[model samples]
Target: MSHDKKCVVIKIGSHHTIAGFNNTELPQCILPSSYIKKGNDYIFGTINMLEECIDKYENESQQTLEIFTTVDENGIPYNWTVIEQQLKYIYETELKCNSKDFPLIITVPHLKNELANKVVERYFNLAFNKLNVPVFQIVIEPLAIALAMGKTSALVIDLGSSGCNVTPIVDGTIVKTSVMRSRFSGDFLDYIISERLNDLLKSDTFQMTDTDGDIILSNNDSTTRSLQTKDSIDIWYESNTWIQDFKINMLQVSDKELPELERYYKEQAEIQIRQQEQLQQYSTNNTEAKLDAAAIASITNNNPLSQKKNFLFKGNKNSKQTVSLELRECYQLSESLFNPALISDKYTKEDGLGEIIGKAIKKAGASVSSVGTNTVGSLGASMTIQPATNQSKNNNPFGSSIGGNASNNSTGGLNGGINSLGSSTTTPEHIYSTLLTNIIVTGATSLINGMEQRIIKELSIRFPQYKITTFANQITMDRKIQGWTSSVSMCNLPSWELAKWYTKTDYEKESNKDETKEN
Candidate 1:
C-alpha cells in the first residue's frame, strides 16, 4: 500500500477510544474500550452487541463469556492482544485505511519513567511490528489538552472515568513530579449515584407512583412488577452504560457546600411542617365546613417541596420504570468531588479536587524553584518570574462573594496574593500565579453541569490572589473528544516539528543498535 501522508490520531481513553484522520475537526469513530471474551475468542467494538452478549451468556449455562476492558484505571492498556485487535478494527473497519499507509498518533497518561519506557517500547513494537505503521508517536493526555486549548503552559485537570489528574505543563514540558491523581471522578460518581439510587429505592420515604397515581411495588411483590432486588440492584450498578448515562444526564455539581445545601433543605422542610400545622388548625376551626379542593390545590402549588419529578430507568427485558426523586438528590451525587467525605470515610477535605489542584501547583512551583532556575528552559525571558503586581491584588474577577470567605487570613499570601501552599517566601510566587491563571479543565467528567463554575468557586476560596481562569470546551462532544482533536491539531504542524515522531526507520535502527550492543 502507498502512503497517504495523512496522520491517524487515536486517543485511547478508559471508557472510549476516539480515532480519526488529522484533517477533520472531530473524530470519525468513538467506540467503547471494552471487549467481550467468549472462551478463547475476543470481540472488539461490542457496543451494539454488549447487551445481547450478556443476555446470551446468562441464558446459556454451558457457555462462558467475560467482558474485559483493554485499559486500566490509569488509561494504560494491560491487554496488548485486545488493544492490537481494537487498533486493527479502528484502522480497517472504522477509518477504512491501512495502518501501514499513514502515521499514527496516540495518547497515553503520564507514568513513572520506568513504566513509561516499558509502555513506549510496547507501543513502538505494536506499531512497527504488529500493525506495520509507517510512523508512530505518543502524546501525554495533559500535553494534548494544552495543545487543544492553544496553550504552551497550563495546569491541566483531567477528570475521566478512572479519576482526576492534575498535571502542570510549563513551556510545553510536563512537570512530572508535580502531577496529582485523585479517585473522585466519573467512575466514582457512577458508583455513588448507583448507591444513592439503591438507597432511594429501599427507603420508605421514597414512593414510586405511575402516571395514574398507582403505587408500584418491588419485583418480589406478587401484585405488581418488581424493580428492586439485591441481584437486580447489583446488575443495574454493573451496567456501566446505564450508570454513565444517569451520571451525565441527571447528575450535577452543587455550587454551594454540603452544609449550605443541607441547611436550605432543612429550612424548606421546617416551612412545610409549619404550613401543615396551619392547615390542620384551619381544618379544626372549620369543622362545620369542609375545606374546598381549590384551597388545598392552591396551598400545594405554593409549596416548592410538593413538586416532584420522575426519572425513568430502563432495565433489562425492555422494562422501563420511573423513580421519583428530588432534584437535590441528583445534585448531591457530584458533591463528593468537592467533599469526598460524603462518599468515602477514608478521604478527607484535603482530598477534594480544589485542594489537590492547590497542592499540585505548589509542588510545581517548589520543583522549579529548587533547581535555582529563574525560568524553565526555553520559556524565554518574557515568561520569567516577577513580583506580584498591585492590579492582581486589588482586582478579583471571580467576585467577592463567589467562594465565600477567602482563606487568605489563615494561609498567608504574598503581597495579598494567594499562594497554593499557604505563605511561602522562598517559593517563587510568579510560577504559581502563571499556572493558576492558565488552568485548563478537560475530560469526560468535566462535562458535568456547573462543574467549571464549582471548580472556580472552590479554587477562589483557596487561592484568592490570582483571577482564576479555567478554559473548558463548552460543547460536550468537543470536550469528550478533546484528546483526539488535539492530537489531530498537533499532526497538522510543520514536518520539522513532527520530527520527534518515531518512524519505521527509527525503530529498525534502534533494534539494530540493540543487537549490536548485545554482540
Candidate 2:
C-alpha cells in the first residue's frame, strides 16, 4: 500500500526557460543575433527551440503534459501568441476540487522542443495514451495566484517582465481572462533603468546584451569594469537606483530649501497644467468612479459564471444564488518576478513591497477581519414512538349521553389498542445552515499565515468542539542579499506556528468511506 499520496503544483519561470540556449559555460543563451530588432526574430527562434524539445517528450511520454498559457478573452498572447514552450524547469499547483488536504500546486514548463503543431500546448496525448492516472486543469498564472490566496474578491496587479497585468477576481474566482492581460513587468522596469542609464551617461548609443541575463555595464570610458550582476549589477539596478535618486534629491537639500523645491514644482506643475488644458480639447477621457450608483452593475459585468445558464432546464425559473459565482482560473506567480524586492519585503517593515501587494488586494473590494473563537454544530436523528394525550379524562356510565373517558380499548373495540405514532423526520431545511465566510487581507508579511490564523480563530468560533490543526510546511525560494533568511518556507508568512481546524468526526454514524450525495 502506498501511504504516499502524490500531489503537486508546478510554477514555470522565464528565467528557467531554455530557448536557443548554450549551456556550455560560455553563455546560457546564444541567440542568432546579439540585439533583437523585430519581435518575430524572438518568436521564430523560440519556435525552432520548441521543435527541438519533441525528442525529450518522446522519451518520457508517460507523464501527463498539460500545456497552458495565460489567455486574453480571445486567446492571444501579448494579444498575440500564448506562451507554451517557455520554462525549461518546474514549480507547484493546488487542485481544483475541494480536499481537506489540498494537493501541493506545481508548475510545468513546455520546453523549446515540446512544441509540435502548436506553441506551448501541453502534450495532452500522454494522459490518454501513456500515463494511467493523469488529470489536468489549465488557468492563467495571476488568476491562479488570486485563487490560491483564498480571497473573497480582488483585482490582482501582477507586475512582471511579461507585462503589468491588472485583473479583478470577484468572489473566489475570475470574471474574465482576456481583459486581464498585462504587457509590462520588471523587464519594463529594466528597460526604464537602461533608458535612465543612457540619460545618465549622456549618450544616445549603447548596446544591452543579456548574455544569460547577466547585466553588464561597459562604458566608452572603459573604467566601469564590465559590471556583471554576479558582483553588483542586480544590487545596483534593483536596489541602488532608488537609493541613489533619494540620496541625490534629499541628501544636501536643506529643510528650508525643501519648501522652495515644492513651490518650484507646484509652479512648474501649474504651467504644465495650463499646457495640458490647452491639449484637453484633443484628449479623450471617460472615467469610472468606484461608488457610482452602479456598483452591482459593475460587479456583475465580467461574470463568466452567469453565462452558465442551465443547458438542461427548460423553464425560465429565477435562481436563488444571489452572489457571483466563479470559474476556476488555475495559475501561479513566478518566483523570479522581482526576486530582490520580494526578498527584501520579507525582511523589513518599511518599504515592504509585500505589504503593498496585500493592500492592493484589499483595495480591490474584499472583506477582511481577524477570526475569534465560537462553536456550533447540529445533527438530527429520528425514530417512531406511540402517541398519548397530555390531559386525563373522567369515567362516565349509566346515562351514556356523554362519555369523558371513551376508551377505544374497551371490550367493544376490535383493534383499538394501537394508534399511529408521530415520526420525527428531518427535512433538508433543518441542516445547520451557515455561510462559508470569505475573508481577504494582505500586508507587509505573513499574509497567508495571517489568513490561516484568521481561519483558525474563525473555525474555533464557528466549530468550537472540533480540533483545528495544520501540517508542517518547508518552502524555499531563490537567494537573498542581506539579513539572515529564516528557512525560506512561506515567504509571505512571518514567524507563524502551524495550526488546524478539525471537524467533529464522531457523528452518529461512522465510516472510513466518505459518501456524499449530489444535489
Candidate 3:
C-alpha cells in the first residue's frame, strides 16, 4: 500500500488489455486480450502474425492454428488459463518485473452481482495463488475512470468494445441503480460495417475495378478473388486485424443525425447531377465552358456523398484489391451508435446512445437520497460494504477496502462509504447539478472523431433545463487508457488512504475465518 513500492495497474478490457506500473503516466503494454494456439504452444499479442498464418494456410493445409480471447463478450474472463498466461507475459516480458515485488490493482467492468462476484473471485485467486502477488485489489472501471478525470461525481459514459455502459458515480461511489448498459458499441459497429460492405460489394452500383476501369471478376464468381461471395466475406471477417484497422482509420460520427445528413448529401448530389447535364447540353465559349467545368469539379470535391476513398483489402490470398467506399458509408458505421434502429429493427429509437445517457441520469435523479445507501434490488449489484464475515453482501465482496478513500479534496482515492456525501448534506438538486455539469466519456469507441461533440449536441437537446458540460480527454491515448491511468494515480495516494487494497495476509486470515465458520 506504500507509495514508495511500485504498484502494477492492469485494465482487462473485452477487446484489449493495458498494463503498466502505477508510477508511469501511460500503460507500458497495450495489447489484444487474445492468443493464438498452434499445437501445444500459445502465442500472445501476435495478431498480425496470425493474419499472415491464416493467409499462408488458407488452402495449403488443414488449419491447426486457432485464436482465443481471454474474456467473453460481456468482458468477463471466461478462460482463466489464458488470462493467467496473459498476466504472466505482462509481468515477465513486458514490465520485466517480479510479480511478488509489487502490489497489483486491476480494473473490471461493472456487472450484475453473480457475474461480478465470479470475476472478482477468479482474479483474486489468480493474483494471490498463481502470480504469488503479495497484495491485490480490484476497482470497478467506472470508479477508476471518475478518479482519473479528477471528479468524485460524474455521469461516466464508457463506450467500450463490448458495449456501452452508462454509470453514475455519486460522491465517488457507483450509483448501482442508475447503471444502464446497451449493445450499441464498437464491436456492434464492426458488424454493421461488415454487413454494409457486403451489400455494397454485391450491388452493381458500387463496383470494384482496376486502374484501367475494368471489373476484376464476374459478379457470379464465388472464388477467393471475389469478395462478393459469402465465403470471401467470412474470410475477411476472420482477419479481424484488417477490419479493426479500417474502423480505427476511417470511421467517424457524423455532426448531424444520419437521416438529416443523408438528406443533405442527397440534395447536394442531385443539384450537382443537374449541373453536369446542363453543362453537357449547353454550348458556350471555351472560357465559359472551362469555368463551368471548374465549378462542377469544386462542387463534387466538396460534397461528402460524391467523395470516395479506396482501401486495400488484404484478407484473402492472392486477393489484394482496392475497395472504394463513399465517405458517407464510413460515417454510417458510427452513426449506428447514435441511432441503433438505423441498422436493425430489433432496437427501437430508445436504444440510442443519447437515450441511454438520459435514462441513467433520470434513474440517478430518482434515487438521489438512496444514492450511497448501497442496495439496488435485483436489477444491479449492491454497493453495500459487507461485514468481514459476509463477502457475498455486495458486488465488491472485497468491500470499501479496495475503493480506498475517494475524497473530493486534492488527495485522490476511491470515493464511497457511509459518509460519501461528506459533512454537508447533499440534496437531490445538488447531486443532479454535479452529475449534469461533469459528464465523463471514456473508452475505445469514444476515440472516434466527433463522438464527444455529438454526445454534447444530443445531451443539450434532451436536458434543456440544465447547463451541460461534457469532459472527454483531448489526448487520444488518455481516453483509451483512462481507467488504467486513474488506477496508477490512486496508487500514488498515501498508504493509510489505500487500506482498501487486500493483501496476502488479509486473504489468508479471511480464508482461515471461512474454514472456521464451515466447521
Candidate 4:
C-alpha cells in the first residue's frame, strides 16, 4: 500500500492564530481570541484565515496539501469550531477549484511528545504520503516540544500560555496498556481562574469593573477603534487585557434578517397547502367552463371608464421561505456552557480526549474513545539541535524559508545533530511511538485510541523481528532490536559541538554504561 507522493503538515499556533492582542477597545476573550460572541452563540472566525493560507500554498505550487487538524475541547472551550472552520474553509475553497487531492483528517487534539515521531513521520509517510508526493509533514509546536526534550522513557509536559496537557511515553512505542485521560488544559486553567475572580467582584449594583473604574459585562474582545466613556486603564495592561471588542463592527443584522426568514417560511408553507387543496378539489370533476373560469381569463367592460388589469406575479421562484430549518443534525453532546441550568462539571468535564478502551495493553484509552481513532498522533520525539546553544530552538531551516533560496542542504528544526550508526534514511531517521495518545481537541463525537495499538500489532506481525519505530528521529539498538528495545535514544548521538557538554565518549557508551551499572 505504498504510493510515491509527499505530504505536508502546516500548523498555526495559538499566539499566531488567536488575534486581538494589542489591547484595543475590544474586550479580551479569556481564552484564545478566535471567535466573537453573538449574544448567545460563538461564531467561528478563523476559517477565513486558514482559507487564505491554503490558497497561498495551492497558488504557489498547485499542491493541494491534505491537512489533518486535531482539536482539544475540554471544559466548554469554544475553539473546536475554529478547527471546524479551517476544515470547512479548506473543503469549500478546494472544492470550488474542483480538487480531489485535498483530503483532511479532523480529529481530537493530542499532546504527548513520544508519539510525535510515529504518527507524523512513520505512519503518515508510510501510509498517507506514500499514496501521493508525500514530502514529510512537519510536527507543530507541542509535538516539537516533546521532540526537543531529549529522553528515551520520560513524561513530556507542555503548559503553553494558551492551553496545557501532558503526554507520557515509554521507549519508542507508547505504553498502550496504561491508564490515560485528558484534564483541563493550561488554557482552561487560565480562563476559569479569570472568570471565578470576576464572579466574586460584583458590587451592590452587581456590575463588575475592570482594573479601571469602568463597568464590565462579557468575555468577547471585539471593539477596535477607541471611543470615550471607557475609563483609561494602565498602559502596560493595555496590550494584554484592555480589548473591549473583537468584532469588526457591532451591527445587529441578524434581527433584520429574522423577520424576513419567518415571513418567507410562512409564505412558502401557505402556498404549498393551498396548491395541495387545489389539486384535491380538481381531482373530482370539473366542467370545461369551471376549469377555465378558475384559470382567471381576462375581464372586460365596454367603456366603463379606462380599465386596466394587473397580473399577479407568476414567477417560478418558490413563494414560501424556510425560516430556521435544521442546518446540521446537532446531537446534544452537552448543553452550551453559557445556558441556564448549568450542567455539573463532573460528567460534562470530559475533554473528549481518548477515554474508552478494552482496558488492555492494546488500548491506551481516553474519556471519549470508541472504535477507529479520530485522533491520531506521532510518537517518536526529542530533537538534539546542538547549534545555537544560547537560543533554545532557533535551529537552521532545511534551506532558506519559502521566499529564500531552496538550495540549503543543511537541515532545520530536529535536523542536524545526527551522528548515528544505523543505515536509515533522512536525518535522525529512527523515531518510534512512545504513546498512543492522539489528543484531537476538535469536536468529533466518535474517537478511539486502540487504532495505534492495532497499527503496532499489524506492523509487528508483518516485520516479525524488525522493531518498528517511526521514520522521523531514527532509533538504534546496540544490537538488532528483535522487535524489542536493546538501547534506544530519542535523538541520535549528539554532534561534535554538543559532545563537549558530554563528559563521556559517546551516547552509545553512555547508554551502555548506564545498563552495565544497572546490572
Best by TM-score: 3
For model 1, how does the per-residue alpha-carbon lDDT over 1-519 read when each residue is reduced to its tens digit?
A: 223357888988888888998878778898878776667776666454466455663474446555677888776788898899989988888999899888888778776555665676788889999999887777666766774566656799999887899987654556667888887887788667666766665553434445565655454454222333433223423555567677766777777786786677667755765576667668788534544566655644554433455667654433346676666666767888877987778889788897898888888788756644333223221122122222222222111101111122221111122223323432447767778789998898998888898888887887788778889888888888887887776566544233245678866776675557559
Which candidate has the top score in lDDT? 3
Regions more than 4 Å wrong, model 2: 1-4, 13-133, 202-519
lDDT of 4 at 413: 29
Worst 10 residues of 2 by lDDT: 478-487
TM-score preference between candidates 2 and 4, better one: 2
> Candidate 4, residues 1-519: lDDT per residue as tens digits?
122111112233342222111112221121222433333443333444344333543364333322222332321223443444543443344323211242221111242333332233232332232323212222223223333343323223322323333333332223322333334332333233223223322211233234453644222322211111122111111112311110001101111123343455556655655565566567854422232333322211121112222211110111111111121101011111111122244535233222211122133322112211222222222233332121122211211110111111123322233233332221111122223222211111111112223333434553344454422112211011100110011111233232112211222343465457559
Give one clash count per candidate, in the order shown. 2, 54, 5, 70
Better model by TM-score, 1 or 3? 3
* CA lDDT scores, all candidates in order: 0.66, 0.25, 0.69, 0.26
Q: Estimate, for each residue in 1-519, the C-alpha lDDT of model 3 and write its tens digit.
A: 345788888998987899998777778888777776767877776555456466644665555665667777777789998889889988988999999988898888776655765677788889999999888877778876776566657899999988899988765566666788887898787777666656655664333455565654434556423444433224434435567777767787877787788788778866876776667557553334433566666765777764787777544343445677777877877888988887789888798898999888877776755433322111011122222323433434454333232122212223333333234545555666778898998997898888988988887777777887888888878888887887776666655344366777877776676567668
Identify the runs in model 1 with alpha carbons over 4 angstroms from their true place. 1-4, 51-62, 203-217, 221-240, 264-309, 373-427, 511-519
| Model 1 pairs whose backbones collide | 218-226, 219-226
Candidate 3 RMSD to the correct structure: 6.9
lDDT score, candidate 4: 0.26
lDDT of 3 at 244: 72
RMSD of 4: 25.4
Off by more than 4 A, model 3: 47-59, 204-221, 225-240, 262-306, 370-397, 400-429, 514-519
TM-score of each: 0.76, 0.28, 0.80, 0.27
